[model samples]
Target: MILSVALLVPWATGAVLVALDGRRRAVGWLAVAVLAATFALLAVLTAQVLAGGSQEVVTGGWPPGVGIVLHADMLGVVFALLSVLVLLAATTHEVLAGIEERVFPGLVLLLAGGLTGLFLTGDVFNFYVFFELAMTASYVLTAYGGGRRQLRAAMVFTAVNLLGSFIFLLSVAGTYRVTGTLAMLDVGERMAVVDPNAALLIATGFFIAFSVKLGLFPFHFWLPTVYAGSSPAVAAILSGAVANIGAYGLLRFGPTMFPAQLRLVGAAIVVLGAVSLIYGAVLAVARGDVAESLAYSAIGQVGYVLVALGVGGPVGLTAAVVYSVVNALNKTLLFLAAGIRGPLVAGAFAVGALSVAGVPPAAGFVGKLEMFRAGIVVGSVPLIVLLTLGSGLSLVYMFQMYQRAFWRAPAPAGPASPLPLRLLTTAVALLVLAAGVWPEPLLAASGRAAEGLLPGAAG
Candidate 1:
């Protein structure tokens, strides 16, 4: 019942918003209120899943194998909550600033609906359905400003990601043809008996699709222009919320559906991740624009996730989960802060920068520590050295960008930022600090989420 409500509220609200005049403050705040309600419902659902176990419901009371099953476990619920919080924050930020587009509020609500469904559905085909829902909203959201630059970014984003989406659909077709099922659990169970050659090809297709979404080193050409061209709120949603699809897909599909293939290609994945870290960091140092720099930095951040995944164990998986959560929060804070200039905004940016560099007193340090622990557990000296060098490069670039952006006088020419926006960033920075100082809960949650997917652990 809770699972159904969690998925429906945002979806229904979004539909209503599409017909209404959302440019009015009432409509916009109503949208925010609806999102807040949805977030509350999801929070309750998360607590229920954490306290009891996975909560599942099949549509129309049909059998699990036939009906669409909505599944909420520790892993799915956590990412869902993280994504909603980001949307909530971004929406709040936009509301305080006054929405420009008539469709802005509706689009955001629809995007939330899409993201919620993607995180909860148990079927791969439903995953694709929700993924398209989210991506479609994002495609329009990218052109929010409707400037020539924004239109170009949206076009490129649509073309590149549409290709990735087709590849994903191809993989889905292969999975179904080979396994005779669209349900993820069924696919996982059956993959063990399927021909290795077929399974490997399907896995590679998924890897390519998600890599393009994550802006991984090789498939990342479209990201910089898009990020640089979009408005701040849209950029935050893309980096902080939408990008979760990639990390979540890799985690779910790799461990749950293709564990054997993951094991076989673990080293190659690690090599790719290492290259991403080096390439993203070096390029970030060279870019003059903050958006472009952060674009490359986003690339560097996901490398840690892939590296941890390649290590392939309880420690490695937990590290990947932890890093994903922390990175989402850090990016949300930084992206929002970058658009605002005021007193104490610099401090917020500093917190985000330090977090990215894995410095003390920020959530990112916890992620870095686990990655270090994963490297040690794998006994990979090369990984350890490479990770350290990546951190060094990160610190140099992050601080250099910080000093240039924040330490300089705010242009007397530009309008001052709103108090509400400044407060939002400050609050996010404080949350990042609190999580770092008291990381036991985040650590335990990551471990439990990983265990739910790991071999010999509870599902």
Candidate 2:
């Protein structure tokens, strides 16, 4: 029941809100109320699962062999919680700023529902179902501002992601053909016996699909245009919530279904990460536009996730999870803060900057600390050096953006932000600070999440 409510509540409310006037305060509040309720259910489900164990639900009460499986483990739960929190923050920021579009609130809820379903499902095909649910909404949401620039961004996003979706579906088809099963566990077991060549090809497909989603080096052409083109709320959702799909997909599919292939290309993956780290940071420092620089910085931040994945053990995977969470929180705060101005906004941006720089008392420091551990465990001197360079570059670009965006003498005639927007950003900033000060929960949760990939895995 808890599982069902967690999946259905946002979906049902979003369906109702699609036709309503979300610009009105009452309807906007309704959207927030629905998200809050859904979040509370997820919290309950998280506690339940932690106390007990993973929960599994097969639709139609059919056997696991015959029905779609919805499985919730620590990995799924932690990601779902993080995604919902980001959606809530972005939505609240939009609402408090006076929602302009009728579809803004509803689309966000639908995106939430889709994300929840995608994260929780155990069936790969069902994964595709929920993926589309979210991507379709996001494609539309990218066009939210309804201008030439927003529309063009939507077009690029849609075109590239559609091609990615096609690649993913083709891979799915091949997996079904070879393994004769869509259940992740079954696929994992069968993949060992499947033709090695076929498996490697399919793994490459999955890798490319996720890489495009993440905007990694070489496949990142669409990112800056889309991110800089979209409005702040939409940009936040894309970077903070939707981007998780790619990272989570790689973690789930690679280790569980394509472990051999992952190991085979682990070093290659690290090289790509290193290149992305260098390329993104260098370009970010050169870009003048605040959003564009952050877009490139985002490219760089994800390199750390790839680096940790390449390390390929319990410790490295744990570092990957921790950094992913921290990056999400940092990007969400920074993007939302970009839209608002007045007292306190500069402080909020500074917190985000310091976090990205991996400075103390921000969650990003903990993330980098874990990455350092991962690098040491792997005995990779190059990884350590690359990390140092990345950190220094991040500090340079972050302070550069802060100076230009926030520290420039107060705007002469710009609109002042409402208190709610200021308060929302401040709350997220404090959350980042608190996580750094007391990181036990983040560390433990990420450790447990990595354990899902290999139970009893030791660093």
Candidate 3:
């Protein structure tokens, strides 16, 4: 029941806010209260899980194989915590900016609910359902401000996601036809015995869908435009919260549900990730706008996670998990700070830029170091070389953006709107910095989460 409440509280609160209409300023505070309550609830649940206990709840008291099942495992808890914290920070920033319309907060809550559903779902078909829930909300949120560019970006974003969803549904149908069950764990066990031809088609479909969502190489066309056009707040959510779904899908389904297929497909994924790292870094160096540069940087950083996963070992997977969490926080801070100007904002950007570049003692460095260790563990010399070169390119582009944004003098005497500052916003930035400098706890959490997913590891 508590797990279910964690999933529903956000959507339920959003519904109340929507019913209250858009004019009331009190709705904003209500939204904050709802998320704060959610944070407290999640903390309790996380503590319970860490104490060697787990919870599972089936909707409508139906059987596990037949009904929607939500479970609180280590992996889900980590992501749920990340989602809640990021949304809290985003909501606070929006409120302080005086743009706290009812719809904005409502949509943020709705987005959080959808992600919760996605993370908690234990059934394959239910995963697709929650995936749609999250995607649909994200599509609308991306275009919430509704300008020409935003509308255009939203169209591309919607079309691509819808197509991906359709393909995912087709895969689900294929899997069901072969295995006759939608339970994720059961499907994984049965898939090897199913007809190879059908399995191949289904696996290909799932790969395409996940890759599209992750914005891998050729399928990533929608990302830059969408990031550039959306509000910085919305951009932070998309980059931080939404992008994790794709990585999660790959981590959850790829190894467990489609092991044979992953073995066949892993090299391609590794290649795509490497290409994205170099391509995105190069493009960032050429980009002029702050938002666009961060967008490209996100591509590169996510690529690192992909490459780590493609290595396909306990160490590699652990590194990927750590990288995903660290990258999400770092990217969110960078995108949020990109919207800021003035001396204080400049300092924020400098700190965030160094962190993103994998500077020493930051969270990003922990992830980078782990990734390098994983590459060595796998004995992949070429990958080691690529990772080193990728890190160098990342530093070059990140420092270039920093020099342009912070070091360059403001244009002489023409009036420009000053960047807003609020305590909540600064706190969020500092928290990210703190996590980077002292990341042992997050690293331990990520390692435990990865071990829970790995075969023959203690749960």
Candidate 4:
């Protein structure tokens, strides 16, 4: 009952809100109130899961194989909570800044519902369905400002993601054909006995699809255009909330469903992660635009998650989850700050920049520390060196962008941002600081989430 209500609140509210003119302050606040309610419901659900166990429901009370299953374990719940928090922040930020389009608030609610559904789903086909629901909302949100640059970004994003979705659908079809099951756990168990060649091929398809969504190197060409060209709130939502789909998919599908394939490609994944790290950092340094630099920074930041994932153990998986959470917060703060200018805005941006550079007293430091631990646990000298060099490059690029954006004298500043906007941005930065000041909760949650995937090793 809790699971079903959690899912329904956002969808039902969003459906009604979409018909309203969201540019009206009342309608906007109504949407925010509904999202806040949804978040509270998810919080209740999370507490229940933590105190007891996974909460699951099969619609209509049918058998597991026949009914659609919604499962909430630590991993899925953590991601779901983090994603909605990001959405709440981003949506609130946009509303404070004044929503430009009539559809903005409603689309955000729809996207939130889609993301929550994707995270909680226990079935692969339903995962795809939720994935499309989220992507469709994002595609429209990308063009929220209705500017030429934004329209172009929407086109590129839609085209690339459409291809990725097509590939994902095909992979789902192949999984069903090979295993005769759409349930993720059943697919994982059955994949072991299926033809290795077919499994590997299907695994590769999933990998590519997720990689495209993640904007990983070699598949990252479309990312900068979209991130740089979109409105700040939209960019933040894309990087902070939407990008989780890729990371969550990788963590869920990799070691669990296709362990053999993951082991086979682990080395290659680490190498690609390294490439993305250095490539994005180097390119970020070369870009002059603040948004473009941060876009590239986003590309580099996810590299650490990949590196941890490729390391493939409880510690590594924990690092992946931790980094994913911190990265989302960091990007959300920076993107929102980038769009505003006033008292406390520069300081807020600086905190975000420090976090990105893995400076102590910022949440990113914890994530970086976890990555180093993962590398050391594996006794991989190259991985450690890569991490060290990546950290240094991250600092350099972040400093450059900060100096360029905030430190330089402005020609003539426009009107200062609203008080609520500044306060909201500062609040997010302080959350990052608070997490760094006391990381026990983040670490514990991440460890538990990792244990859910790997089952025994100390995270």
Candidate 5:
């Protein structure tokens, strides 16, 4: 019941709001109110899942394999919660900055609903359905400002991701053909007995699809232009929220359904992660534009999550989950702050910079610490060395951007960004700081999320 309501609120409201004039104050605030209500519902669902266990509802009350299932467990709810929070913050930021488009508010609501549904779904085909819903909204959102740059970014984003989607759809078809089931749990159970060669090929398809989404290495050429060209609010939403689909897809599909294939390719995963880490950080140092620099930085930041995931254990998975949460917050704050200039905005940017560098008194430190713990647990000397070097590079580039943007740069000749915008960025920065100061809740949630991937853990 809770799961149904959680999905219903944003989706229904979004449909109604699509025809409203989102540029008006009332309509924009109304959209924000609807999102807040949706967030509250998800909060309730999260509490219920945490206190009891996984909560599931099958449409039409049909048997498990027949009816589509909306499921809420620790892993799904946590990611869903984070995704909504990012959407809420980004939407509010745009409202404060003044929405430029008539449909901006409704589009955000639609994206929120899509992301929530994808995170909670149990059917692989339904996951793809919700995933496309989200992507479709994002494709339009990428062109929010209607500038030539924005339109080009949207074109590149749509073209490249469309390719990734086709590959993903084909992979889904292959999975169903091989296992004769689209239910994720049933697929996992059946995948073990199927031919390893077939399973490995399917796993590779999934890997390529998710990798393109995350903009990993060779597949990453379109990312910088899209993130750098979009408006700050949209960039925040894309990196902080939309990018989670790839990370979550990797976590959900890799270890959960294809453990044997994952084990076989673990080292390759780590090597690719290491290359992305170095390449993104080094390129970020050379970029002059703040948004472009941060775009490259995003590529580097996600590498940590991959490294932890490749290590593949309770500790490693926990590290991956924790880092993903931290990275989302960091990117959201930094991207939003990058567009603003005023008193205290630099302070907020500094906090984000420190967080990205994995310095103390910021949530990113907790994520980096978990990565170190994972490295130690795995007893991989090279991994530890790589982690150390990556952190160093992250700090160097972040400092360079901070100094150029906030410290050494001249005051803007135009009026400062609005007070509300600055305040909102500050609030997000404070949240990052609070997470670092009191990390027990985040750690516990991440631990529970990781457990969901373990064998014999409740589905």
Candidate 6:
């Protein structure tokens, strides 16, 4: 029941918000309260899971293998918590910035709800449903502001995502036809016995779908334009919450269903990731807009996760999990800070830029270090070197953007009122960074989540 509430709260809240007049300030508060409550519930659920309580709820009284199952295992909880935190921050920031257009808050809540469902679902078909939910809400939000650039970006984003969804559906159908089960755990157990060629074809479908979503090298055409065109809050959600689904899918499906194929194909992924790291960084350095640069920076950051996944050891897997959480927070902060418009905005951007550059004591630094260590243990020396070069490039581009945005004199000073909401949001982002710097709690939580997948390593 609690798990169901966690998945449904956002939609429920969105319904209530929709019924209210959009012109009133109270609607925004209502939306915020709903998200805050949802966050509280997730925190409590995470605590219970950490205490070794099982967090599975079966719907319609169906058996575990056949039922719609929602499980808050470590992986699910880590992402759920992240989605809640980012959504809350974005919502509050929007409310404060007086950008509380009626549909905006509701759409964000819907997006969060979809993500919650995605994380909790234990069935493959259900995963697709939730994926569509999240993607659809995001599409609407992308074009919500009604600018020409946003509209164009949203169209590209929609077409690509819809095609990915179709591929995902075909994969799901193929898997079900081959194994006679839609439950992910059961499918994994049965996959080893399926025809080798059939299995490979089905797995290929999943790979192509997730690759497009994650913006892997050849398929990443939509990322820069979307990030550059969307509002800061929307960009934060896409990079932080939405982008993670790709990595999660790889972790969930690849190891369980295609271990042999993964071993065979892993090197290709590693190579692509390495190329993305260099390609994205070099392009970022060549670009001038702060948001566009960060957009490219995300490409490199996500590539690190890909490299870790390709390594396929316990340490590498752990690094990937931790890196996802750390990178999500860091990216969210960087994107949000880029939206600041006052004299102090430059300082805010600098703090965030330095953090993303893997400055000491920050979350990015910890994640990067762990990943490098994992690469060494896995004998992926080239990956380790590429990651180092990537980090150095990140520092160069980020600081260059910082220097231009802040240290460069602003066109003659003009009268302007400070945005209180933006300031508050920046404060929240700073606090999030602080948590990352001293990330004992999040790391412990992540360790517990990683344990479910690697039971032997769950110390």
Best by TM-score, which number?
Answer: 5
For residues 299-358, what per-residue lDDT tens digits would candidate 3 score against the true structure? 788888789878877788888889888888887777776766666666676666777777
Please, what are the lDDT tens digits per residue for candidate 4 over residues 104-140? 8889999989999999998999999999999999999
Q: Which sections of candidate 1 miss by over 4 Å? A: 409-417
Clashes of each: 0, 0, 1, 0, 0, 1
Give the Cα-based TM-score of candidate 4 against the true structure.
Answer: 0.97
List lDDT for all candidates, in order.
0.89, 0.89, 0.79, 0.90, 0.91, 0.78
For model 2, where is the 10-residue window of minimal lDDT?
409-418
RMSD of each: 1.3, 1.8, 2.4, 1.8, 1.2, 2.4
lDDT by residue (38-152, candidate 1, tens digit) is 8999999988987898888997899887777899988899889889889988888788777878888888889998999899988999999999999999999999878998899
Tens digits of per-residue lDDT for model 6 on 1-459? 778888788988876676666436677767778888888888888888778755778877898776678877778877888878888877776666556356888888888888988988888988998899899888888886788988998999999989988999999999999999987777877888999899989998998898788787777899999988988778888888898788788877887567766777888878877887788889899898888898888887788777877787677777778888887887777777666655556556666676677776566777887778888897767777888898899999998888766667464342232566547546755665676578788667655655566523221
For residues 332-397, could you state the per-residue lDDT of candidate 5 as single tens digits? 999998877876789999999999999999999999999999999989999999999989999999
User: Which pairs of residues collide in candidate 2?
Assistant: none
Q: Is candidate 1 or candidate 3 better by lDDT?
A: 1
TM-scores for candidates 1 onward, in order: 0.97, 0.97, 0.94, 0.97, 0.98, 0.94
Lowest-scoring 10 consecutive residues by lDDT in candidate 5?
Answer: 408-417
